[model samples]
Target: MMEAININHFNRHKITEADIIRRILSGEKELYEILVRRNNQKLYRVIRSYLNDEAEIEDIMQNSYIKGFTKLYQFKLEASFSTWLIRIAINEALARLKEKGKLYHISERAEELNKNTILEIPDKKQLNPQDKMIHHEAKQLLEKAIDQLEPKYKIVYMMKEIEGMSLKETALALDLTLSNVKVRLHRSKEMLKDSLFVISHDTHIFEFGFSRCDRITERVMENI
Candidate 1:
């Protein structure tokens, strides 16, 4: 039923990094679709954690791929292609957040970490509908709660909770002291928990974009 190439019937058994590079350099621009399809879900989860707008998610993702392709020639054998691409994606997603006024308190979170600030969240159903209505609602509530956080906490939440980046990676990315990242992450999670439990009807901020993007992923997969 797939409208595209039968990936299962590819003449080649695997797509290695060298193969991808060769294809790119040989002027096979459309071949990049293989890479895009392979990485879409991974990239989506990365974007979803920090952003709620599905269309904007597509915009940012498309932007990331463009940036990655342009920078492909600069890639080295030091890191896997996917790792390098993910770094590019994360940077793009963060930049998108900044442009949308989601990033705030740009300096305070860089302060030394204290015992007072840390982010924590209880287990909650994510995109799964059957997980529990209250918990599903909690996820939406959490997004709204995040919009209210100071830039410091927001960045930490975006990096840790959404992107699942290790603390070391996050610390390096934000140029923050390790403790600072941890503390802010803790505070952000706590705030989100409190917000999600309150049951908000004004959840318009994340409703539309997320659903649409989710649909896009489904369509792409079903067709491929």
Candidate 2:
């Protein structure tokens, strides 16, 4: 029986992602679990930016990982594996949207589309139960506002702001120019800030918990 390996073990050994991929391609197939565990959060966030359905997002994520594994030989070692994987995930999500007729091209004028939007967050510390509730509600509101954004802008925001991916990596993943990524990110913030009196930089807005992470990893490992 294969034991579940914690990603921290990889970190402790200072094993690079390239090394893992090399080993996986060299017949150490189980090492792929390390990549899955390492990227589950980021993959979930990127896919969540496109689709709102949790089950659908998990399905797409599983398919993306399986697809990526099958195509591991084609992955360029000099490039970032996360970015490559994200590109695959994004393509999968877009294909899903296209199948449902929800995929629409947003022109360069997407920044001008949603100008009159407002999102307000109350500036309160979560010192007590009541304050915690308020904070939770505020996060939900912020997530809803993000979800309502056009796909183009929302994707940029999700990658740069929510996922904390570098500008270069985000551009590479989304196939956008650096300037375009900056522009979309700025416009996304402006769209949200127009009505957002107070902003909270909560990174845990669309958190994918440990249980779901394990489930996704197990399912993908089983299928692959």
lDDT of every predicted structure (CA atoms) = 0.60, 0.84
**C-alpha displacement of 190 in model 2, angstroms?**
0.9
Residue 163, candidate 1: Cα error in Å is 4.0
RMSD of each: 7.9, 3.1
Candidate 2 lDDT over 7-41, as tens digits, reads: 56776898999899999999988889889988999
Q: How many clashing pairs does model 2 include?
A: 3
CA displacement after TM-score superposition, residue 100 of candidate 1 (Å): 6.8
lDDT at 13 for candidate 1?
A: 70
TM-score of each: 0.54, 0.89
Task: Please give, for residues 167-194, the per-residue lDDT of candidate 1 as tens digits.
Answer: 8767765668899888887777665544
lDDT for 45 in candidate 1 is 54
Query: Judged by TM-score, which candidate is best?
Result: 2
